[model samples]
Target: MRRQVLFVGLICVTFLVNAQEEKTIDLDEVTIQASSIIRKKDRQLIFPSKDQVRRSMDGLDLTRRMSLPRLWVDPNTKSISMANGNVQLRINGVLASSLEVAALSPEDIKRVEYHDNPGLRYGEGVDIVLDYITIKRTSGGNLGVDLSHQLNTFWRADYIYGKYNRGRSEFSLSSFANGHRYKEAWQDRTEIFHTPDGTFQRTQEGISGRDYEMYWTTTANYNYTKDDDYFLNAKLNFYYYDYPHNYSSALLRNSESKMTTDLIDNNKSLNTRPSLDLYYFRKLPRKQSLAVNVVGTYSNTDSRHTYREELESIPLTDIYTKVDGKRYYPLVIGIPCAM
Candidate 1:
């Protein structure tokens, strides 16, 4: 019940700007921080972006690790706070992915660097500050696939696949899922310690409820690399959630008969969230990189609470059956109220 409110809603960025700062991914090529770096294989540009950091470390992390220079992100809150402290990140003279210093998987990284001073290619007209991040996809590299499984109350699995090569092509994909059956029983007690004569009524009522859940999320991406060393990526991500519930309650008293009923039936919900990303990547000779990413998202929830009640033979107690040579009955006789 507590998980519904935070289903989805998030964003972070506090700064003045004139045209979005180029993605920090292009920082290595455009800024001076990436000066002390070396590339072993065919490369165009590599930069830093904590985007994956927040993703891999989401509320329920699967199996991914990230390295960042400086950042404060909470999984429960989905909020982030970062500062570069005189360090400016740039990509081809433009701002890139928002991050100060970072580390991530090779597939998600193009290049990396540490700049001591800010440069014109880093920012256009934004208030200059220290610290930045740049990131982009590899153009023609081979993809490495990662998958894992956890067998328990339900089957759970995660996957990651993507590649880049010779700075000319790129692609990536990730997913998480689980299925299982769970059984739980709940009992609640309420007492009104009061009577019509202001004495001790000691009214006690007990309630019980049960629930079940099944969920999963999947995302796919595609990228186009141009000879000019600029990368154009089209990303589509889809995620959803589903859960069902049931409930019942009862009341008892010494002077009156006990009453019981099912309060909920067929109460269920299905939710979905889809997002799109458009970003660019550029690499510089000095080991600096740059990138620009713009993303939009949409989410929807569909739910319903169903209920029902059925009673047979208006005089339920008068009608009885024989048990162990004796007659058993509900034992109730009173005036009915139409109100």
Candidate 2:
């Protein structure tokens, strides 16, 4: 009985030792894995969250939060451009413009991502990629206004309004107006010499008496989504511009002849653009999806330019130029399988 007792004790001791050894080995493995995970995380760049974005005022403010030196956002145009200028803008996986981004509010953004080197899937000449993910709002709207004045008599103003609902529909409207004036002065000298003809010398001084420009644009967008699988969007834009210029010059020839000339130029343009986009997605059996996209755009433009010139010794003449045209573009794409 004594020997059996001793054997049982020995077996229990051995089991305990083995169990402790296994536990120690597992702890070491887990430590290594945890250290590796930390290292991996340290190597990756962290993007901003929606909460952080909500604290910002507009897209420019959000860009400033990126903390990247190579990224820049123009305060006037509201355009984001990288250092290399090889970047593309997309909204919800659709091609977009800088104007659209400028109109976005911080609360509308979910996150922002930056890729120094993009893959072939993004197309060519894409050295960098910046993605602005938008939040899915339940039902809300936002309004924005931007105004600025410069020391050199330059000024700009913009206004935007957007709204969305939880019922798979959204709409937005934006308008912009800008105007500026500038003064300029210049001098020109000309000398002409011919073998048989006498030499001629001329000097002219010029100044811009009036230079002014005004521009306006209005844009509207409508979007619809169904069950997160289908999407439809429509956009319309209207634009107008007015420019007028006046100049006067004093001319001296042969040091004894003097003349004066006046010039006037006026231009006006109007444009309209409408676009439609559609998307359909199908889920496959093995965690896959098929997507189809179609896009169409139509544009019309009307422009008129007029110039009038009057010389001291010549008759006043007026020249007019006009342009009127329309264009259309259509695009279709399909993806059979996407993982």
Top TM-score model: 2
Which lDDT tens digits does candidate 2 get at residues 1-116? 00111111111110000000111234453432222111122122335555557666666567666565477777665667776667676666555566666666665565555566
Q: lDDT per prediction?
A: 0.40, 0.59
lDDT of 1 by residue, 81-152 (tens): 346443343332233222111112332334344333334444444333322222444433333323333333
- What is the lDDT for 145 in model 2? 57
Where model 1 places Cα greater than 4 Å from the true spot, the runs are: 1-152, 155-157, 185-210, 224-231, 244-262, 279-300, 307-339
Can you tell me which runs of candidate 2 are displaced by over 4 Å?
Answer: 1-46, 49-55, 83-86, 119-127, 147-154, 181-204, 225-231, 242-270, 279-288, 303-312, 315-322, 335-337
lDDT: worst 10-residue window of model 2 = 11-20
The estimated TM-scores of all candidates read 0.42, 0.62
**Model 1 residue-pair collision total:** 45
Top candidate by lDDT: 2
